[model samples]
Target chain A: MIKVENLRKEFPLGRTLQKELATKEKIAVAVDNISFQCQPGRIFSLLGPNGAGKTTTMRMLSTIFKPTSGNIEIAGINAVTNSRDARRKIGFLTGSTGLYARLTPNELIKYFADLYEVSDADFKIRKEKLFDLLDMNDFQNKRIGKLSTGMKQKVSICRTMIHDPEVIVFDEPTSGLDVITAENIISLIRDCKNDGKTVIFSSHIMSEVDLLCDDMAIVHKGKLLYNGTMENFRSNQQESSLTAEFIRIIHESNAATV
Target chain B: MILKIFLKELKDTLRDKRTLIMMVVIPVLVFPIVLNLFVTVSSSFEKDAAMQRVKIGFVGDAQSPVIAGFLEMPAAMGKKDLIPYPNEKALLQDVKNDSLQMGIIVPDNYQEKMDSMEAVTCEVYYDATDLGIKDRAKSYMEYVEKSARDKRYKSMNLDETKFQVILTNYNNTASDKEMIGKLAGGILPYIFIAFGFIGCMYPAIDLFTGEKERGTIETLLTTPVSRLQILIGKMCVVALSGLLAATCALVGLYLSIEVFNLVDNEEILSIVRGILTPSFIIMLFLLLFPLTVFFAGVMIPIAVYAKSFKEAQSIITPLNIVMVLPAMIGLLPGIELNYMTACIPVINVVLATKELIAGTLEPVLLLLSFGIMVTLAMIAVFVSYRHFGKETNIVM
Candidate 1:
């Protein structure tokens, strides 16, 4: 399970020394006092548009970024205080993160396993299972630089789930992937949920969110516009479709802020 | 866990063609070829200079028996072509026009002076800007002075050897090995430091900034490893490659010197071997260790700040110039390793290296320099670790 309370992050804008000395300090808040919980055996989605602080919130939960003033509890461990321990309980993936171009999937996976302190026997078993599931055996020994995009994505998926962490956070895992590749990622997330792992992912596509999310939250301009089960969201929507409902909430949030 | 990161880096760098060419091929093969070419060109120039005929023009009457006799003797004018000019002005014109390498304006009363046993001056003129002409002119002047003195002795009815002034002059007897060692010491330290820094530059940029540029940094950060562990692992690889490059550069220099037959004397080769004692080799490694560490420590933070490989190269390439200018302090005359200078970083190491290779190492000074370098290296490593801890640097 993952728990975040009053999570807030502020990025200071660059300014000249004279301006900084004369005017009040300027900051753009990326995450603003938002709270959410992800339970085991469920897929929780942070649904938001671009520049809506979903990635920042996910990064904080992964312990990659320290929140300005917030608490993150991952698998009952405080993420900020025991970040290294918290990291072991979570696997974070972003669309921009890439595999080592020079390393074959076998070497890359083994290297990460060693970093995570997975024993040789366990690594061998885990490696076989991931390779088989991702259908990466045919080109497992090929350097990732030579692999196609879909093949590389499969390798990335194998790498992400190698240590089998309790909570997995993915920020737009299928942003640029083809249809078939995106479907593979969605199936993998479903499998993670079936394995009783707490999976939290962020995406903008309402259909993808509606298809995979069990519990979900609508985030816009760093604020939580809605947070509840997908069934509750569907039942509360007066619109005919989930996309229209998502657009309505965004419009309402923008109008209120204005 | 650090070993895992280091080993992966090692494998990746070793497999990279660019790294192999920079680290191995250039040092092992290209250096020797370049060295041989330099030796061949310089030695051929020396031989050509020795064999070439210098043209000398004499002003005034050359019909004098004394002047004719002096010019005829090959000892006084080796491989020279003598010319007669009508007057001093004519001789000067020939020299100025580059038609004659040197012009001698013999005093019109030179014969009278010798007959009367009085002093006389024969002005020698040559273009100082032309090195070849200047050198040959100086040689001719020396020969002319000796021949004139001999003629004076003969005119005075005295034996030249019997009337010679009796005095013993002290002279240096330093061996060729000691001379070569001193010369090499002055030059080779800067070269080694350059190679060491070059070795570290690419790998440092590739491991630090290249990962971020490739978008792999985020994945590495999400692992269970701490920032310090990651920093240590990357630093170890960079340091090892730097040390290996320094070693290869030294070996290349030594092999090239031997292959070029720089010193033909067997005695000199043996003396060189004796100077390169086991103690000397050990001291060299000791000095290079901290230097390479300092290089890696310094490179890491700078490379981490860079956004791409080309950007990092731009930042780090200028650093080689910065390091080299300080290391060149060893090449300056009268520069020596001492208590005060041993505290300075690059210059201290360079001066210490010069002393070590010249077989005049002071242990106290060496130890002081080592401690200072190690301290500075530690500070740099600390800075690199702090840099690794920042998410903005990695994520950017």
Candidate 2:
């Protein structure tokens, strides 16, 4: 299970020439007072558009960064205090992120496996299983630079799941993927949910969220506009599609004139 | 676990072509080309200056002994044997004709200075702007002065055998050849260490920051590993890359030194062998160890801070400037590598390597030098960890 309470992140915007010439430092708040939870054996989508606290929230959970004000627990371990243990319990995948261009897919995945200290025999078995399941045979030996986008994403996805963490965070997992590769990834997320794994996904594409998510949250400009079952979130807005609901909430937030 | 990460890093390093060039080939190739060019150009200048053809015709009567002796000097100089002339006007005509560099106008009173024990001036006329010919003329004139001084001393003592004995008895052991060679060797090691540092900088940054820039760091950090393990893993890769790049550069430098046939004249080979010592190599590697770590600590996470490849490029380009200029300071000719310098990181390694290669050092200085470097390396690693351990991890 993963839980984030009242998470807020304020990033200091580099003092512009105008600001520096004046008196005070300037900052832009990226994530603000967002709260959510992922129960065991369920898929949760922290749905948001670009710049919408989705990646930032995932980053906080991954320990790649820390949220400015928040409490987080991954499987009963406080993420702030015991980030390493929390890292062990979570798998993180960024959709647009690339693999090491110089390393072959086999070497790349195995590297993360070693970092996780997975037993050697198990590492080999799971690695072979990923290769076979993902059907990465043709390009497995090739450097990542030479791989097609879908092939690279397949390789990246395999690498993310290598450690078999309890909570898997997929931030924009299908952003640039082709229809086939994207479908494969969606099926993998469903498989994780079927296998009693906790999966948290972030995306703007409402259909993927509609198809795979049991629970979901709509975030706009760092605030949690809505959180509930995907069915409930869509029904509450009386919008047929997730995108329309997202646009409606954004327009409502924009209506609150500063 | 760290070893596995290290091995993976090693594999990654080997696979990158640009990295291979920065870490391997430049050091191996650059020093030799530069040094050999310096040596070739300098030696040629010296030879061309020394061997320039000249003729001197003495304008004096053949009956005069001093004038007859003056006519013999051009032959002794080897480039131009002197030709006797009938009068001063003819000698001047020969000089104007360009048939002679300058006519030696040794007068009848040429030997009178020694007889009276008074200083006599010998005038050499040559074009002021013709530096090479002027240099030769100056050297020949000084030779005449020294011989005159010797002849006066011999005349006062008036014993040929006693004069020879006194000359041999003077207790002096300075050999310009040996001294020059040692100095050359001492300075050469500084060049080698400079290449060592330069050769490693890009590769070290590439090892850490390159990985971060490529987005591999996000994956690495997501692993179920401790921060120490991550640091060790990353550090081992970068440190080893630095050490390896330095080794390639050293080999190239050693080869270049061998090709530098002129350095043999300095008698530095015996001391030059000191670079091969395990302790010297170990100390040098240790000195670089911290810098490599600091670079990785500074660059990798910093690289990750960039939102794009272009941004990372902007961040890295300035470091190259910040790095090479300072190292070239100790690398230039005549700079001394002293004990006090050993406290500075890159500069210290350059200096210590120089002292070791020259074998002109006190062992206490070596120990003290490397001791300071190691302590500092640890501190740098600590600072890196302190920054990496932050909740930001971006050094904000």
Candidate 3:
């Protein structure tokens, strides 16, 4: 399970940024005070528009960025204070996550496995199972730079799941992918959920969120507009559709601030 | 974990064609190609200069004692053909038109002056631009004058030694190795510094900035390893690349001397071989190791901070000049390793290497230079860590 309480992230404004934003504030808050929990064996969705801080929030959960203030617990380990140990329990993937193009899939997997300190017996069993399930046996030795988009995506999924961590963080994993390639990610998320892993993915696509998430949070401009289970969200929807409701919430928040 | 990262990075770096070219191909081939060209071109020039027969044009009577003396001069001073002219103007014209390589004007009463023991000045002219011609002319004239003086001395019937006074014998106290070291030792460290910086450059940029640009650093950061471990692992590869490049250059130089026979002087060759002893090489590496680390350290922060490979390159490439410029100072004469120079980073390494080659390095100064470089390298590593830890810098 992944737990976040009052998690916030702030980036200092450079002189250029200050001028561009026309603000004298020394810092720009990317993720404001917010709290949510992702239960194991269920999929939770963080929904936001561009610059909505979904990526920043995901980064903090993955221990890539330390929060300004708040607490992140990964599998009962305090992620902020014991980040390295917390990182061991988290599997983070993003649509923009880049693989080492120069390395073969086999080499890349082994490297990450080594980094996570997976035992030899476990690495061999996991590698075999992943390669077979993904149908990656034929091109595992080919350089990733030469792989097709689908092939590379399969390799990335295998890489992320190689350690089989309890918490999986996916930040817009299917953002730029074609439907055929995106299916691989959709299935991987399903597999992680079925394996009883705590999964949280951020996406702007309401259909994807509606299709996969058991619980959801809607955020806009760093603030959480809604946080509840899918059942509660569906029952409380005032708009004609999920997308319309999401748009309505954002518009209402903007109008209220203005 | 650091070892694993180091091995992976090394594998990745070796696979990069740009890093391979900078770290291996160029450094290995540069010395052999340059040395071969220098040797071939210089020897051809020497052969051409030696074989050409100079035409000597004279404006005095052909039977004059001075002309006879010139005719009798040895052939080894370089081959010559004497041509008689009616006057100095015709001789000058021929010399100017390249019909004659030189011109000599012996006075009409040259024999009378010689018989009377009066001073006689023979004017010899040659173009300064015509490389060896002027020296040949001076040598020919000096030979004829010396012979004429000997003849005059014989006629005087006095002891030749009586007029001589204050005979001087100058000697050098330094060894051939020391002389070569002081004069040319700057080149060794300069090569190491140049190649080391270039070698560190590509890997440093590719491993740090390239990782960020390619979007791979984020995944790496999410792994279980500490950031410091990753930094150090990547740093080891960068520093090794620099050392490898410098070593390739040294190997190239060795090939030029041993296999290519670029240097033919037996004495010089012996000195070079002696200077490359195991202890000397170890000492050279001792100076170079921290210097390469320092180079890697200096470049890593920029690489980590840059948003793209091009951005990192634009910043670090100019820094090469700033870093390597101090090594050039060692090429200058009289800039020995001292307290002040020992504290300066690149310059200290250069001068210390020079003194090492000359076998004159003080132990205290070597320690000081090493300590300073190591300290700077640590500071640079710390700066890189700080930049890398910044969320804004590491990710776009």
Candidate 4:
């Protein structure tokens, strides 16, 4: 289970020497007063467009960034206070993250497994299962630098799941992948849900959210606009497509700000 | 767990072409080849300078038959080329133009002055900036004086040897081996320190900025490993590579000297052998250990702060000069290891290494120097740890 309450992040801009004493420090609030939860055996999607603070929220969840003022609990461990323990219970992945180019997929996966302190027997079993599921046996021994985009993504997925953490966070994991590869990631998310793991992913693609998320939150301009089950959201749409519903909520938020 | 990170990092380092070239190829091959070329060219130059053909310009006719006979001696044949000038001004012009290695103005009253028992000074001119020409000109002046003295003695029928006060000759009597050791002492310390520091640069950049540039830093940070663990793991590989680089430099220098027979005298060879004993090698390792750590520590924080590999390189490149400059202090003649000098960093290691090699090492100074280096290295590592602990520094 993963829970976040009133998570917020503010980044201060660098000051010029001339204005250092005269002007007050300026800051941009990337995430503000956002709260959500993802239960075990459910897929929760943080839906947002570009610059919508989804990545920042995910970074905080993974303990890579400390929220300015908030509480993050991953699998019953407080993320900020006990980050190492919280990290062991979380597996974070993102499209921009990468594997060592010089290491083969086999070596790369084993490296993470060792970092997570998985036993040899458990690591072997997990490696075999992930390789079979992702159909990565053919190129597991090849260096990652030589692998194509889809193949590298498969290796990344296997690496992310090697330790079988209770909470898995994916931040735009399939943003630039081909349709087939994107479909594979959706299936993997569904598999995680079926295996009773908590899954939180952020994406601008509505179809991905529709296909994978049971509960979803719509975020914009660092604030949560809507939060509920996908079924409730669909029924509340009144025959409108998910995209139209999303546009209406964004327009409403824009009007309120105006 | 740190071992696992080190092993993985080491595997990556071994596979990198740049690391292999910096760590292995250049040190093993480039030094020896360059050393051989330098020795060959220098020795050839020395031989040519020794057998140099000198042009002697004469301003006036020879006064005494004795001086003329001395000038035409068999020893001067083929080696000395004589040119006659109408006056001292013409001879000065030739010497000024460098066409003549030396010029002599035989006084117009040469024979008259001798008959009157008066001292007549003959002017000799040569380009002082040109060592070879100046040396030849001085030798010729000595010959002229000898001939004049002999002529006066022969005229009076006096014993030249009996009238003269004690004659003296001065020359360098040191063996080739001692000279070679002195020369090597001034240079080797700078080379070893530079190589050791350079070895740390690439590995540090690749391990620190590389993770950020490759986007692997994000993944690595998400692991359960502590920041300290990660720091130790990366630094171990960096320090080891630095040690290897320093080793390669010393070994390369040794091999180069041996292969070219550059320091060929047996006495020098014996001194070299004594300097390269098991204890000496152990001392070298001890001195380099903290230095390697210092290099790694200095490199990591700077490299980690950079947003790209190129940026890291630009930031780290100036350090090469910073490191090399202080090490060159060992080359100064009067600098030696002492209590105060041992408190310094690169210079201390340099003076210590030089003294050890020169068989003048003070054990107390060595221990003090080692303590200073280790203390500085610890501070550097501590600073690196503080940098690593910051999420902003690691997450870029």
Candidate 5:
């Protein structure tokens, strides 16, 4: 299980000495006071618009960045402080490839496997299964630099799941992928949740989030606007679609915050 | 776990033919091209008429035995083919205008100084700004002194050996080629150490900074491994690659010596074993590794701060210039090095290598140097870990 409490991140407007001496005219709060939890064997998504702090929140939970004021626990480990341990428990895949271009797909998988130090038997079996499941065997031998974007995406997904951590996070997994590839990723997400893993994803794609997320929180400008199941979210809004509901709630939330 | 990442880097870097070629092929071939060019240009320069010929405009009398003898003396020594002028002032004027390669203002009292054992200042005039003219002028002056000394000895009715010694003293032991090679060799140690260190610096920075630039640091950090372990594993691969390149450069230097017959003062094959010693190996291993770590520690934080590989490269390129220039200090004669140099990172390595090359390395200096380097490397590796752990805004 993963938990975040009062997670907040604010960016100072200037870094230069001259600029720093001048008072900041504007302050950007990437993530405002927000909280959520994902129980074991559940899939939760953070559905929000652009600049909604969904990615920033996920980044903090993944231990890539620290929150300005927050505490996060991934699999009972303090992700904010005991990040290395938390990292061991989480398999993170960002939508923009973490793929190293010069390595072959086979090499990329094994490298991650080594970094995580998966036992030989488990590594071999897991790699074989991922190759079979994702059909990576066709181009696994080719350098990732030569691989198509969709192929690289498959490799990225394989690395995320390589360690088979208790917690998994994918930030915008299928955002740039084509229709077929995107559907494949959706199915992969469903499979991960079915395998009794705590899976969390952040996406602006409403239909994918609406169809896949078991529980979700709608976030706008760093604040949690709503949190519940899709049925609960649907009932609260008169907007025709989730994206429309997202837009309507954001305007309403913005007006209230001001 | 760091071993796993290191092995992965090794296997990946090995397959990069372009970089392997850059690391291996270029350094190996560079020695031959440089050595051959030096030899060809030097030999051609020595034999060229411009090097030997001195055209002097003499305003003095040729019919008079004294002025005629002064001009004919160098013409006989096979050093200079003296071109005469009408008068002394005319010779000085011609030299001033650069018409004469060398100018001799024969004294108006030329005949008087020889009778009095008083030394006649020849008033050898040539533009000191032009090096070739200055050297030729000095050579011509020596020839005049020899001629005058010979005349004095003959008048005293003494034999060639006794008169030559009493009248004029020249270092008969002087070997010009050996002198030139000594000069060249002084510069060689600097290039060898500098290029060797530079050769080490690139891959060290590449393995550490380049790895961070490639976004592998985050992935590697997530593993349950110590930062020291990661540093050691990666450093092992870099050190081996650097040492391989250094060896390739050394071998290339030897082969160039043999192939081009560069520095004909001694046989390269005969002295090769004496030159490459246990001291050389110890100095490089002890010296190069710590220097590598210093750079590795120094570079990684810079690499960590950058958002991309290109930015990291821009930060590290100036370092190449810095390393190369100090290694070049070996070219300057008798740059004294002591323990104080060991405290300075780049200078110590070059001095250490020069000591090893000259075969005078002390065990104490070696230990002191190696200890400083390794200690610094550990500190650098520790700092890199902090760099990774802190500063959230900077990307891997």
Candidate 6:
């Protein structure tokens, strides 16, 4: 399971940023005082519009960015205090994550496996299973730069799942993919949930959240607007559709501030 | 873990055409191409200068003894054709217009000066811009003057040796190796330092800024590795590349001299062969190792701070001049490896290499130079680690 308590991330504003923002503030709060949980065998989605701090929050969870102040627990380890140990238990992937273009899919998989310190026997078994599942055997030996986008995405999936971490974090995993290629990610999320892995993904796509997420949180301007299960969120929605409700919540938050 | 990352980075860097060219191909070819061109051009110039025929114009009676003296001169001085001029003005004009390579105005009654035992001055004119013509004219004048002096001595019944009061002989105590070492030693280190910096530049940018631009750094950071380990691992590859490039340049120099026989001077060839002893190579590498690390250290922070490869390159390219300019100091005359110079970074290496070639380096100064470079390299590495640990610099 992944647990976050009062997580806040602040970035120092440089002179250029201060001028651009027209603010005297020394720091910009990207993720402000947010808290949430992702239980095993469930998909927890963090949903927001663009620039809503979804990526920052996800980065903090994956230990890519250190929080200015807060607590992060990954698989019972204090992620903030022992980030290296916590990282071992976490598998992080993003749509923008780039593979070394000079390397073949097989080489790339082996590299990530070595980084995670997986045993040789376990690596072989996992590689075989993922390759068969993703239909990657045909292109596994080809350079990643030469592979098609769909094939590259499959290699990414194999790389992320090589070490078989307890918690998986996906940040906008389908941001630039076609519908057909995106189905590969959709199926991978379902498989993670079936395998009893704690999964947390951030996206602005309401339909994706509705189809897969068990529990959900809505954040805007770095503030948590809604935190509850999908079932409760649906029952409480006063709008005609989930998209409209998401839009209404953001607009209402802005209106209240004004 | 560091070794694993280093091996991976090495494999990745080897596959990059740009880095490979900078690290190996260019360094290996630079010396041979340059030295061959230099030797060919210089030898051809020498041959052309020897074979050139000069035209001499004179304004004097053809029956004068001076004219006979000129006609009787030996052919070994150089091939020459003499043309008669009516006056000094015409003779000078011919020299100026390139119709004649030189001009001589023998005085009227020139034989009268010889008969009376008085010195007579003859005017000689040639363009200073004509490279070797002035020297050739001086040589011909000296020969003619010696012949006139001999005739006077014989006529007067005086011994030429008794007329000479003193004869002095000059000698040089320094060996050929020492002379070449002092004069040309700066060139070797300058080449090594230049190639070393260039060798480190591309890989430093590619491994750090390229990773960020490609969106791979974020995922790498997510793995179970400390930032320090990653930095050290990549730094090892960068430093190794610099050393490799410098070694390739040395190989190139070896090929030019030994295999290609571009250098034909026996003295210089023997000195070069002596300088390539195994001990000299080990000492050269001893000085270069820390320097390569320092180069890698200074470059990594810039690479980490830059968000793209082009930006890193734009910044580092100018820095190459700043860092390598001091290596040129060794090329200057009268500069030596004193305590102050030994404390300077790139300059110390250059002068130390010079002294090493001359067999005059003191061990204390070598230690001081090496110590200073190591300390600076450590400080630079610490700064790189600090910059790399900063979240704003590492991620875009």
Positional deviation of B297 in candidate 4, in angstroms? 1.1
DockQ values for all predictions?
0.78, 0.65, 0.86, 0.84, 0.48, 0.82
Model 4 accuracy (lDDT, Cα): 0.85
The TM-score that candidate 6 achieves is 0.94
Model 4, B100-198: lDDT tens digits are 877877788877877798887777788887766666666656666677778778989999779769888888664444454456775766777888888
Task: After the best TM-score superposition of candidate 3, give how far the Cα of residue B369 lies from its true spot, in angstroms.
Answer: 2.6
Models 1 onward score TM values of 0.93, 0.82, 0.93, 0.92, 0.86, 0.94
Candidate 6 lDDT over residue span B1-396, tens digit each: 888889889989999999999999999999999999999888887787778888999988776656667787998778888889999988888889888998988899788887899987898999988888888899888887888788789999999999789999999887877787789999999999999999999999999999999998998999998999999999999999999999999999999998989899998999999998898888899999999999999999999999899999999999999999999988899999999999999999999999999888999999999999999989988999999999898889
TM-score chain B for all models: 0.91, 0.68, 0.91, 0.89, 0.79, 0.91
Error of 2 at A250 (Å): 0.6
- Give one clash count per candidate, in the order shown: 0, 1, 0, 0, 4, 0
lDDT of 3 by residue, A3-113 (tens): 899999999999999999999999999999999999999999999899999999999999989999999999999999999999999898888889999999999999999
**lDDT per prediction?**
0.84, 0.71, 0.92, 0.85, 0.71, 0.92
- Listed for every candidate in order, the interface RMSD values in angstroms are 1.0, 1.6, 0.6, 0.7, 2.5, 0.6
- The reply for model 6, stretches above 4 Å from the true place, is B56-72, B83-130, B148-157
TM-score of chain A of 2: 0.93
Count clashing residue pairs in model 2.
1
RMSD of 5: 4.1
Of 1 and 6, the candidate ahead on DockQ is: 6
**lDDT by residue for model 5 over B263-297, one digit each (tens)?**
57554444554565576565566677666666657
